[model samples]
Target: MPENPVLDPKRIPRHVAIIMDGNGRWAKQRNLPRIMGHKVGTESVKDVVKTARELNLEVLTLYAFSTENWKRPAIEVKGLMTLLKTYLKAEVQNMVENDISLRCIGEIEKLQTDVQKIVTRVIRETAPKREMKPSLTLNLALSYGSRSEIVRAARIMAEKCVSGQFDPEDYSEQLFASHLYTGGLPDPDLLIRTGGEARLSNFLLWQLSYAELYITETMWPDFKGESFIDAIRDYQSRERRFGQTSEQLQAE
Candidate 1:
């Protein structure tokens, strides 16, 4: 078992997002194919999800694959899709038993029909689970791009306005957010990126505007429960002002 800090429930982030990176580089260092690194990285996923659920996290969004990822070699893309399908199929029973529901926030239609079927089945099977603390949701951002998500939301809002379903007087930030892919979920309070990367990499741009970022040098395959604990601790140490001055925050 991994030793971890006892987090304060009041300060714990309601939603956590991760950009899992460095698979290819980790594999290269070992003189193995990149696919092998991804395979090992899946283990890290399972560990992190289990830990998050144990910690009572409300939502965990993983940047599993991006629209840009499709530009990789055909064989590598195929391998990734196959691995994802296999993992999803195998994890459905575990999800049901643990009360962890699955959700996909991306161009899900872009995925192969068989893979989509597996995802839909798992989601349906886990939908009725209500035993988990805080109701865990594991969001996989496959074929996702933040810019496209925003544009899609904008298009929907525009159509509503044109059809007289929306009024200018009813426009608000809350309304805009409701049309996003992450519609009902709270914005991520913490965004973590592994493998030493510092950029968002076009992931969750609008949603993460005010999220606390925690970057680490550890690669995805090596990141586990302890690593997540460290990040959460770091987040707890910081003060979120949300554009207010320190004095203003102190006065509040």
Candidate 2:
């Protein structure tokens, strides 16, 4: 792992979100089955996670599968689920050994019963490790759609109001955010999309409100640890004023 020469230790992102894209395209380019691209992408996942842990990143969120992903071919969906199960089974030990907590932020219950069982088991098994402040949390956005998540959060808040457990007048950005799927976690400070995608693609709409966006043409399967470090370094070079003018930032 080569150190990123330009990364500032003082300005590490508290949360980093990634859109791992182009698996099928990567495979198509190589004249291989799409699943083969996914298999290699899993290797990228491993490398990225290790790199995040080494950098002491507080939270790392991966756009693993989206609610819209169900529209893909059935065989591809099944293969993805199988691959997820296998990855979970194999990585639980690595997560524990590294004091990383595995978390899911999507409609996980909608997964196949068998896949759900494996996900649940791994989550339970890794729930106890906490060696760092944020414990290098790795959140997989499975079957996740930010719009649906926001709607669900609103529904819950509405129900709370109806039940008199909440006061509508007490609402604030913070209060409403607490109802989100990523309620307790910090909003992503940096959002990286690979395989040349320049859009959010409906992932983390609310949480990425002010996130610095980095788009790379590298396919997910080929994105390595050094690539991740480069993203961080790029992020460190930008100014994040959060609505403040440059003059205001300088004055402060």
Candidate 3:
């Protein structure tokens, strides 16, 4: 069992987002195919979800597949889909038992029909479990772009402005945020990228504007509970000012 931290549980982040990277490198390091690394990485997902829910995280979003990921070879993509179906079927029961519900972000329609069916079943089955939301982004990105999301939101706002529904004075930061896909979800406090990568790679362009980042050299397949906790502790040590000066923050 992992040791519990000494701090008040209230200090834990309400939402945590992760960019699961380095599957190919994890497999290549051992002269194995990248697909194997992804398979093992799936197990790590189960481990992290179990630990996180126990620790009371309200939301966890995983960058499982990105719009850019579709550029990869066809065989590898099919393997990932198969892995998703298998993992979801097995874990959904456990998640429901533990009070964790599921959600999907990004373009989920590109997934194979069977895979979609399973995902739907699990989501409905786990709907009653509300302690945590476990979300996956299939970024099928079929054509997802952050710039595009912002432009789309602006267009909607423009339309509203032209109509009688929106007042110019009501257009605030909160109003713009409500127009985002992640509008209702709490923004990620800590964004993690494994396999030593430090860049955002076009992930969560809007939501991560104020997030603290943690990069790990450990490949995604090897990312376990201890590694995850290290990232959380690193996050806890930082100060999130949201644009206030250090002196002003201290005064508050």
Best by lDDT: 2
Candidate order by lDDT, decreasing, is 2, 1, 3
Computed on alpha carbons, the lDDT of every model, listed in order, comes to 0.91, 0.92, 0.78
Clash count, candidate 3: 0
Which segments of candidate 3 are over 4 A away from where they belong? Answer: 1-7, 129-148, 151-170
| lDDT (Cα, tens digit) per residue for candidate 1, span 108-210 | 8998898889888877888853544436999999999999999999999999999999797888889999999999889999999999978999999999989
Pairs with steric clashes in candidate 3: none
> TM-score for all predictions?
0.95, 0.96, 0.86
- Using TM-score as the measure, the top candidate is 2
lDDT of 3 by residue, 1-252 (tens): 447565457678877888889999999999999899999999888888876776688777788877677788999989988888898889877876777777766656777788879978877887753544443311112223466567768888889999978888889878987886567778788898999988887777888889899998989999987778878888888889998988999998
lDDT of 2: 0.92
Q: Which ten contiguous residues of candidate 2 have the minimum total lDDT?
A: 126-135
Q: Among all windows of ten consecutive residues in candidate 1, which has the lowest summed lDDT?
A: 126-135
Better of 2 and 3 by lDDT: 2
